[model samples]
Target: MPQARLLPAYLVQRYHGWKATTYQDNKSWYRRLAASGQHPRAMVISCCDSRVHVTSIFGADEGEFFIHRNVANLVPPYTPDGQTHGTSAAVEYAVTSLGVAHIVVLGHSNCGGVKGCLDMCSGEAPELLETSSFVGRWMDILRPGYERVKDVDAAFRARALEKQSVLVSIDNLMTFPFVAKAVEEESLTLHGLWTDVGEGGLEQFDPVRGEFLPV
Candidate 1:
């Protein structure tokens, strides 16, 4: 077996600091969580971008949210083909096991994954077109979203596509049988959101208006 390297000194120091402060202060809470297990009421599907802080945005405490992060915060159409599907697996667990009442697909401004998808679809990012590029293949899920905003003005295309990615994920979430059933029975609800990384602004998708409105 390959030996794993030790954590960096900086990370170890940070851990020690956290253990001495946060963990020590909330020792009983941590012990209760360990003994009981997580029972988050919501599942947040967010982008892998470090700037998009899911917990901080909602002011969530430990064991409050079941978060799944990926490129562009995508949820691909359900496919039960006996292949590995990490996002799908997370959704299944969140719905069937965790019984989360809400699933929020959170997209953000200046998202690199969305930008890459736009570039790739426009043929500008040729390297991502290669079969071996995992990101390219993953971003393929957003092709339908790209198609919707392909005619948008140059200045606003990226932002438009970013929101569309969240909508697409919400639509894709319904493709899962378990998710659909849960929603139909009124046990689960889905939401779409977009955040301005620079301005710290947030908007939510209103299904009735089919538009994103400030929140």
Candidate 2:
């Protein structure tokens, strides 16, 4: 639940006094619109990184991007074969119930989650990994991607890992029945995005071009 929207404003008024203007100015706006309901056009699956905010990065309004975040933003393959999947359920709601026409999988440069996985896969010194942590489980999703590019030149390893994960996520997402149906009907388009914070540039995934290019 959203504590910001639920807490009695006055209870924390002093602590949040700095944001008083935005809070008071938009006091009723959020409730009014949230009560009406959400009709976001796209659902974005992203990493829960402090620097990679879905709305700020995409310049989206309140409900423009139905965002679902996880440690590394991996999309597990759909299995009606009874596996519990929160991300899968969110995507189902977006595509089947809410009728979102697009879904974007966002990957970013120098992601710690991806780095952790790569380090683990390398059989590096024990000091390189911190297993038995939730972050370890989250990074495990990149195993397939890591295996795919393990033999690439050392110079391109970082870029390769990021790109590989984005492609893996796209492939896994398509395993969903609804996603397959949408693609068959051409009603939904799946996109992959890679963010470069240093240059502040966004790259779009292009399967045919086999590279991330300027959008």
Candidate 3:
């Protein structure tokens, strides 16, 4: 078997520096965490976009948040087929094994995945229509969301779909039986949040108001 290639030198140097500083600053915390185990109270489902920093936004510490990131931060409807379901597997681990009390679907402004879905639904991005387009199939999870926001003016469709993605993921989360049971027993709670990347503003979804409001 062949060994994996090494990372770039710059990244390796940066990682070493960070490791040194982290050990100097919080050696005991790291040691304790290693001896004990993770007991995160929340699971954050977020986008794969590099701009969205989940821990920085929430000021979370190590072992505090169990995060699962995918394109558009989507949670597909529960399917028990014997296929690889990465997001579903993460949700199962968070809910059943970790017993996370809260699940937060974090969406964001100017999401490329949402834009891709918008483009695909609008018949603008023809390449994504191919059966081999993994991203296209993943973005299909947000197709229903695109339908709900498609009628909006082109200028605002991307933002609208972004928020809709959060709502859609929340709805899908409930489709999982364990998640539904946890909610019914008051053992688990769900939240929807969207962030404006440029303005650095946060908005939370209100089921009662059926809108995202500033947080």
**Predictions ranked by TM-score, top down?**
1, 3, 2
TM-score of each candidate structure, all chains considered together: 0.98, 0.84, 0.97
State residue 49's C-alpha deviation in candidate 2, in Å. 1.1
Instruction: For candidate 2, write residues 1-215 as lDDT tens digits.
Output: 45466557776876587457765778687787679899888999988878887798767767678899886778877767676778889999999999988999998888877877787788763444466566666667788999988999878887789877788889998999889899789999999998886778899988898888998
Candidate with more favorable, higher TM-score: 2 or 3: 3
Query: Which prediction has more favorable lDDT, 1 or 3?
Result: 1
The number of the candidate with the highest lDDT is 1
Weakest 10 consecutive residues, lDDT, candidate 2?
124-133
Of candidates 3 and 2, the better by lDDT: 3
Q: Which residue runs does candidate 3 get wrong by more than 4 Å? A: 1-3
Point out where model 1 deviates above 4 Å: 1-3
Q: In candidate 3, what are the lDDT values of residues 116-202, reduced to their tens digit? A: 999999999988888999999998998889889889988888999999999999999999999999999999999999999899999
lDDT of 3: 0.95
Evaluate all candidate structures by whole-model CA lDDT and list the values in order: 0.97, 0.82, 0.95
Which digits, one per residue and each the tens of the lDDT, describe model 1 over residues 1-215? 47888899999999999999999999999999999999999999999999999999999999999999999999999999999999999999999999999999999999999999999999999999999999999999999999999999999999999999999999999999999999999999999999999999999999999999999
The 10-residue segment with the lowest total lDDT in model 3 = 1-10
